[model samples]
Target: MEQHYQLLRKHIEEICVLTDEEWDVVAQRFTYKSLKKHQFLIQKDQLVPCEYWIIKGLTKAYAIDSNGKEHILQFAMEQYWTSDFNAFQNKVPATIIIDCIEDSEFFCLKWEDREYLCHEIPKLNHFFRIKSHYGYIALQQRILSLLTETAEERYNNLIKKMPKLIQRVPKKLLAAYLGVTRETLSRF
Candidate 1:
């Protein structure tokens, strides 16, 4: 539990330093959770009560279309955050589902607690703002890639940017993420 908190501190410190007092305040607001492989973290049409910071293992955020095809949106691992951002922010039902790819542990922060922490600590607010900016930029880049790049190009770019992801995520999930069939992905 202490180690998980330390990991959270390190993740935040990458953006901005936190004083001990502030850290204590920030730490207490989070609750620990663990889930086994294949467990649902956020199910579609359900409420998203908190955003989770991964302490260990991997998870995938995806949506199932009316035809029952899974569309992978994101893969989150240790030190990464995962949530149904649209629902979490709007206080509505989730449009996507998040599930554990492996047994996972996380520190969960409810929306109200997050808001309180941001208001109480200016540096924490700055850290979150920077993190959100990066997330937005990444999302934009992903959209542009899907719109303009071929599957092969996207695969090459993903390998170049996040080789570890290729190694960690299953090929089928990678295929879905790249908007390609498994057979097509196999050719790359």
Candidate 2:
């Protein structure tokens, strides 16, 4: 538990420095949570209360279509921050689901708590803003890849970008994320 907080502190420091007192305030606001393999973190139509910072383990954020096919948006692993951002920010019911791919631990920060922390700590606000910008850039790149690149090209790019993720996630889920069939993914 202490190590998890330390990890979060380190992750934040990568973007901006935090004083011990500021760190203490930030740490106290985050609540720890654990989930077993295959457990739901956010279910569609439910209210999403917090954004999670992964301490350990992997999860998938996805949606199920009317035909019951899954469309994976992204995977989250150690040091990643994830949530149904639309729902969390808008205070609306979630449209997507998040589920643990492995036994996972996270530090959860509620919207109000996050707001308070950002207000109290200017560096924290900068940290979060920088993180958001990175997230947006990643999203844009993903969109461009999907629109312009072939499946094989996308696969190669993903391998280069996050080889560890390729090893940790199942092939089937990878296929879903790449918008390819499992059989097609196997060829890459």
Candidate 3:
């Protein structure tokens, strides 16, 4: 647990330095948890009150359409912070589902703690703001790829960006994420 906390500290310190006292205060607010593959972190229609920073393993955020097809919005891996952002920020019910793709460990921070820390520690605000910006940029790139790129093109780009994903994530999930069928993905 102490080692995992150090990992979180290192992730934050990359954005801004935290004093020992400040780090202590920040660390105390988070609760650590572990989840098995197939466990749901945020289920659709449930209230998602916390955000999580992945310490190990992988997860996916997706929405199921009326036809019961899953459309993956994003993948969260080690060092990434993920949650139903709309639900966490607005205190609303989740529209997307987040589930573990592999056995995972995370540091969870409740909304109250996050709000308080953002105000109590200005550097923490800087850290979160930077992460948010990068998240937005990634979203934009994903949208552009979905709008214009062929599924094969998207698959190639995804492989280039995350070669290990093909090995780690199930092909069906990867196919859904790439807007291709599993058979189509196999051809690539």
State the local distance difference test value for candidate 2: 0.94
lDDT of 3 by residue, 68-167 (tens): 9889999989999999999999999999999999999999999999888999998899999999999999999999999999999999999899888788
Q: Give the count of colliding residue pairs in each prediction.
A: 0, 0, 0
Q: Give the TM-score of candidate 1.
A: 0.97
lDDT tens string, model 1, 1-188?
78779989999999989889989999999999999999999998999999999999999999999999998888889888889999999999999999998899999999999999989997788888888898788889998999999999999999998888899888989999999999999999
Candidate with top TM-score is 2
Clashing residue pairs in candidate 1 are: none
Our model 2 lands, by Cα RMSD against the true structure, at: 0.7
In terms of TM-score, how similar is model 3 to the real structure? 0.97
What ordering of candidates by TM-score runs from best to worst? Answer: 2, 3, 1
Error of 1 at 173 (Å): 0.9
Regions more than 4 Å wrong, model 2: none
Off by over 4 Å in 1: none
Q: Considering summed lDDT, which 10 consecutive residues are worst modelled in model 3?
A: 161-170
RMSD to truth, every model: 0.9, 0.7, 0.9
Candidate 3 regions exceeding 4 Å error are none
Pick out the ten consecutive residues of candidate 1 with the lowest summed lDDT.
Answer: 122-131
